[model samples]
Target chain A: MVSKSRSENVQIPIGPQHPALKEPESFLITLQGERITKSGVRLGYNHRGIEKACEQRTYIQAMYLIERVCGICSHSHSTAFVQAVEEVAGLQIPRRASYIRTLIGELERVHSHLLWLGVAGHEIGFDTLLMYTWRDREVVMDLLALLTGNRVNYGINTFGGVRRDVDAAQMEQVLKGVDILEERTKYYITVATDEVTLINRLSNVGKLAHDDAVRLGAVGPTARAAGVARDIRKDDPYAAYADLDFNVVTATQADVYGRTLVRVGELLESCKMIRQIIKNMPDGPVTVKAPRKVQAGEAFSRYEAPRGEDVHYVRGNGSDKPERVKVRAPTMANVQAVAHMLQDGYLADVPIVIAAIDPCFSCTDRLIGVARESGGRGIMTWEQARQAGIEWHRARGIDFTRLNETFRCGEPR
Target chain B: MQETQAVQAELMKTFPGLGEVRVPRARRIFWNVPYAEFARVFEAVTGPMKFTILCTMTGLDLGDNLGVIYHLARTSGVTLSLGTQVPKDAPVLQTISHVFPAADLYERELIDLLGIQVQGLGEGPRYPLPDGWPAGQYPLRKDWKVESLEGCKLGQMGVADGK
Candidate 1:
């Protein structure tokens, strides 16, 4: 093999194409031998320029663009973005619209978490877990497709409320799917934690301390796994979450396994929440009346995505097009926590550890990118390659000073 | 806890350093605190009211000033949001990552999108924008125009300041 070493420290770009990350997000992992010394993350590869795109779109058109933000968590993004606009317009959605939104949001959570489970399983090389989780996830997506037009970007959200209304038959189908999903998710939760091989590979790996998770500003399952009990749904209580009661799962381990368990636990919680929303649903119009002008104002709206809290800030200028719209997905917050998770982990465990964050490469890509310093024999086993990537970041420089800024929680500035 | 007035008065007493609490339209009560009191105010609310959950954090470029919003909530049905606006020329806020770890991503995102400085955050490169994305080119600014199809390079449109 033609092997040439440029420096003692060499950096290799892991993605925008790595199996470990779902979106086209890249990471420069600097390593020393087989252990990661540091890691640098870069995004903006898939910068659909959704925010800029929102500026050119009409209020109605912005909803569709926001829905496409993440294929998995599209509903949450749409609901949050549309809700912010609705709030600025002072439009009150009908009771039926709110309940339908709650139902669809929970259903989206079911599929999203299941999809994550399947992907997480695949990363750890557990094909059985992948098969079972994805097989069951199809049911939730089918229910979503039945209620809405499309499966991925459900065109249910509008300026005031949902576009579709759920009748008794639709509710029955959703309830049936929820039952099956809950039962299957329970079974997977058992295997996720109890399976010896899975536990051995996941448990205690990518350990992030509670202080570090807080300092790095991890969110969703990443922070929850570190024993930080933060959930936008439970805290902010938008949609049906305000009416329904559910537990916020947390773990003290702050490792790959802890986040895995948190997600696994929430899968069941989402199932239960969906069932409750359907059972106690009210009858009314599915949408509220919205005006042409959004007026000039700025407000921030947040919803609990399957990954974590998804926030959108909308600034309207009394024009059809929004003045400015900014989106912050849960992954944006969780990416900073990756360096803490990878610092002491084995090179072989890098993919699995990164996957534990449930990091959305598409969302991350819209926000940042990692640049690698070239010049090295890029040939090695996956282990050797990752070790070198980690070393490269450490040598180039890795700092977390700005990751610790304080802002008011749950409010708009 | 059942009395909103009592809670408000108690909060005012607890944090005297917080100045001029304003009640905006929609009955939303806001605390206008100095930038340095950001962490203390967060702890006071979440600690006293058990506002243990973070809703969202946002940054705004308000021409003459930069604003950061933090929304917090509790099951007790009390949702309090805190907003601090810093001068645009010298924008800075204390790090609240100590009270709510979830602040980490929001702050990084604020820094990435608005170019607002979140003092004491372990410094890194701007996120969301590519490496070659022009310096000082904030996509969120009201006057930032991306020109046309041919003129735009990557994320830059070169619309020259204001139009």
Candidate 2:
């Protein structure tokens, strides 16, 4: 690898609409040749003003509005919001309701991690892994639809408790589905660890030091991968996590490979927690009758979403409508560390590095881009760019003589 | 809940200017602090009390004044919410982004939506709003009105009624 000090400076803008990003967010990367020196992010392309919109709606209505914040982690959003509102109303839900909430939460985690695995595989040019992971992801989605009646925005959460209840038949189906997921996830762990191409693409890339991970406030699997050991489900123990038995997965690698392993490991843990929740589900009312108007007070609620810790602040004004609602998604906490991780890395590794955070721009769209030219000179032509690339490879002692002979014969045309 | 009381006592003994420490719920504690003591109290929580991660910073338009709530949390799960109010005319406060880099985006959101000026926050372009957005039109301030563009045609084709 070339030393960081000797690389040439160049600025490349990746996207408000790049293929790597599923949502609209841009990263303006400054590269010292192929090695990235600095990176700046710009968000807010899909800003719908959900926080402001929530303030205008009633507490019950805002629950539905907040559920649409992120399509994948919709259950987590509504649960956090409902928890805050329930606290303000001084309502304690039944034990059975909490168990059902935990079950859905864990199921959402399974689907989200599998979805991320597929995206990560596609990012590294492994189309087969992407196809297989997504095909398996459907099992959790089907189970979610069976439980909540919707796949993407599962509107299962109400104010005091959950809106739906699990039956014996659904619980049995969930157990069988989780069994298949557990076995498949164990196989995925082997593939992630032993596959040479996948390991080569992931390991040692986008390394976020353990201290930097904590200092920059990285959360969820991103922080867990760095051995931060901060999961709200385990730490705070809300919504039946206190009763469920599971271990918080951590890794010492603190790189893209570690993030991949951490997420896959969490998949297995979530499956186990799902089975535990179904087996020990308490028998009682699934929901309590919460008052329409909440007293004047504020509550802070946090939930461990699949990506990270998601927090919601709800303030009531003695009316049915909420005074102010603030949502801090995990992506907001993790994106800043992306700038830190991109430093001193190769530009070719940008996609996996950014995707490693599982950036949810739509949720965090509540942004800036500035282009400044310092020491970098003019842009290079296609031929000059190819020459620069060849020279870069030559400096690393790569022998491209045979490839150069074939390229030289067809270049004039 | 015990952790909330412990932190509250620590803050009260450390800083006398803390207005009211209210434990409205089980795990949540709200501290009302004067605007001048906002940064100092935030430092106390993150420093001595060890609330390492800033969960979020919320800016609210409370009719007569603007309020800023700093939601700070520890890895062990206690959340300390420090709230400070400023006059609506001059909603300025010290920036805590230097201490917690996570507060940078939250502060910028306040700047864009609530029209709150955060001193010591370094230079950055407008966030969450386009460059051509009209100035002084703070959307979240409750007073900002959404205008009606009655005759404005959205597409290239002429209006149906040719108004």
Candidate 3:
């Protein structure tokens, strides 16, 4: 995390051992002094071949498999796959199930955005923000477990309808959680807008213009931050999103700062959508019996995951097994943009720019272990490396505790 | 939907060999375009119909031939899927990375996993697969034999089949 001004410009590598290690993906950066001239990304160290595996499983079995695509957006992936299956089966899930789907989705978005805020804070030498946001993120995590019986993989979705229903008591608990999240999100919005150091560090860091965002096929907050105004929940409107009303948050900054604003704004939007779903939930059956074998057909399901646009292309045969299944996780679409964002930027800004995408890849912070021209080095754990980064910034007058203080509604910066 | 039909009309006029056009639902179009007409039809849909949002491509391992479907979308949210099958012996197609930059990743994937040669998608590092993975070995193909892959970690570990 230390920014060095080296006279000798050279190429540096960043990567990990395997899927066995905590961090896996690799990036090779050609640097001109401290600024990057070109960058390359090498992924698939932990390919898992989930798409190939899905084709071997039945529709019922594949639902469980798809849920594990991304741990953060497990519900998003499974829901997209199930919805595609439902569409191909021509089965209209009950209105209640759709509402529950939307409810869980927004809940996931809140927790995910909070998690990203913590990670982004850690990336930019603000460990206090990291500690505070993740502490608040546990509220929604517990609420999710209360609602779906699991924290990460909320197994609420099934082919015909949802597998679970919210009782009156659960509804009360979820609403209480939403109230807490909304209040905390407001504070984050204020901090992100009012904080001077954060603004200076992040603004104009990962600049992707609107046309570049579209041309590079950036999605989720990355595109919205660039003012693309594309949200699957609005444009396509799957599940109960068509019934719900919310704004697609956008910002013109088109950098890491804009992405932070977009995500925080979406956090409030998610909280609002959660309130709407619980207040106006319809009454209907929770589950409908779906056919064992889907008729021979194909469907492309799109979802606005916390990270970006998550899509699943499903082709089912008359047999129980699907003919083919392809998953384009949001990160896959946004990875190309990382190379674009890192171009001509300081090598030290790499972590934040990549983190700006809320990248769902499970790579650890040590994924960017920098070295001098000596060409070999020992390693530090992600936690240890981040601690060192905080200390390094602390040596340079970046006292975090002084920077973060209690917030009022209209407190001056 | 009207835009897709107009493109289909244009395709029919240009090359009179299109077959099996299916409109399963609104804002969704899936049809069988002949291999010879793929490039032009792709351009017409992406150019005229404005389905510039290349969601991704699906490389299907058809029994004797390879099937590639370009899943396209518009800002209006309409989805169009145009699929064509190429001979397994000569599985090659033109690159659309120039039309949409996002196609670079998916096209590289097709070349790596499915053994589909994408013309003009010039030399880059292998994607989603190990660099040491033997050439001419496509895992997604139906008849792919793992024994042909020399240094497979799982195979050497006796994971799937014991030596």
Candidate 4:
């Protein structure tokens, strides 16, 4: 009788931490029957304070700190950061370095797109596709390790140019692996486009119109799927992107399937770009000697990360360390669009809709640990932690007579 | 490249506030304007100028003033940055989310980390900073002493009393 008396609307919280998602993010979803009426995103669970950390470290140290901003897009972040520094320092790297940067960048895009395709499949309960794409992803991963000395955070990007040069043998290995990836991606494309089941499942699940996409400032595949026709590689032309010949792939459906098609199309484009880069590979030093101290100036640099436009702003105060370094990870620009994507979507399609954007869900993680104190420690709640805080403050002779009213501070129970 | 220069020259002539727009390189441009003039100048920049895609807004401390550098560009890739400043005591700027919805979260970031206020921003959570972040203790400010952050270090916790 009590259950029957309840209203149709029900609120469901997805995550600050959740089992369904690989990363930690909080989403409060309001549902009416099986349909979601409203969705809210809560950030800060993974805030790393890397921006503030950059202000304290030297330029060289900051570049390393930036690489860890997102494990998946390490080169994206480092390249953006270094490009801004290079701009401020007024350095033009070698042509060979530019070619190599673009090659590795496209390769990274290939691996990232493959990884996303598998994740999207898994989200839709198509584990077979997940198993297949991930297996093929290893080919690109192996090539990355061969060139950059690591798999995830490749660390290929240095100040003036790339730290590592692609040798003839390494270039051959890359080409051979790309050939395999290209064939596999073509097959996956047919599966994505021709399969009726996947189309039915993902089509129109999360719709963001062209106007909404641009208005929301959606980036990368999210905006491309909605037909925004914007890509930093074409617009800003950082590194070797200026010399590369590739169309900015886009789709007009403004839905999950459109996002898939755009990514699949981009996978082929990356493969094509990589082959051209290798064929036109120049011979020169990979790096120019960087400055010991950057002059006083600022630069705003942008890179088309696998996700979208990655922007980095750096300011030097005539010192070895930078005065400011601000990183706008593509996700930061795309996360707000997720809220719009979930509007009126089915409850079941939440994972796929969020996954469709490939939400990095992290970049900044500047949290204070929840030590035993109550004042400025971590965001700890519960009776035990509450009592410890009161007792600690009492021992410190900090009065608590009126603290209850003040401490509440509108923090929900 | 001439189109970039033309846009730069047009903008300088159109807005009385944009002082000596600096084109350090062919594609990149930076200009200084008073914070009071930001709202007026920003409308023209985002509207007729067509620098609609906001890359980001950078907030920094400038001794006695708090400064904001708004970076924006159209699909063409020529970035023109507008730097403006307000006195530290009254750090406020109008929200541009009406033009670029991406500014919603970035504006929240400025509020939380830089302690700058937005005049027209809608209500939202504290953003990238957690709810527990104490008010008036902006971490990005140069004067916000690092010693206060001693209790925030990892592995520095104690066993709760009466265990």
* Pairs that clash in candidate 3: none
Residue lDDT tens for model 1, B1-163:
3444556677788887577654333324456676777767777787866766565675666788888777665544355567788887777776676666656656766765677777776655555565545456566665665432123233332222221
How well is each residue in A29-87 modelled by candidate 3, as lDDT tens digits? 88887889999987766676667667767888888978987788899998999988988
Q: Where does candidate 2 chain A have its weakest 10-residue lDDT segment?
A: A367-376
Please give, for residues B1-163, the per-residue lDDT of candidate 3 as tens digits: 5755665555557656577666676567788887887887777778866888988888999988899999888887877788998888899888889898888878888887898989988566667765545456677776664434434222211123221
lDDT of 4 at A409: 60
- Per-residue lDDT tens digits of candidate 2, residues A250-357? 999999999999999999889889878887889989888999999998899999999999999988999999999999899989998999988898988989899999
Whole-model lDDT values for every prediction = 0.73, 0.84, 0.82, 0.84
Estimate the TM-score of every prediction: 0.78, 0.87, 0.86, 0.90
TM-score: the better of candidates 2 and 3: 2
Model 3 residue A59 CA deviation in Å: 1.9
Candidate 4 Cα errors over 4 Å, as ranges: A1-7, A364-367, A372-413, B150-163
Kindly give the stretch of ten consecutive residues in candidate 3 chain A with the minimal lDDT sum: A363-372
DockQ of 1: 0.29
lDDT of 2 by residue, B1-163 (tens): 7877887777778887657777775557788888777666777788878988888888899898999888888777888888889999988877888988877888888988898988899865457765444456577887664432122222221122121
* Candidate 3 Cα lDDT to native: 0.82
Best-performing candidate as measured by TM-score: 4
Candidate 1 share of real interface contacts: 0.40
Ranking by DockQ: 4, 3, 2, 1
In candidate 1, how many Å is residue B88 off?
A: 5.1
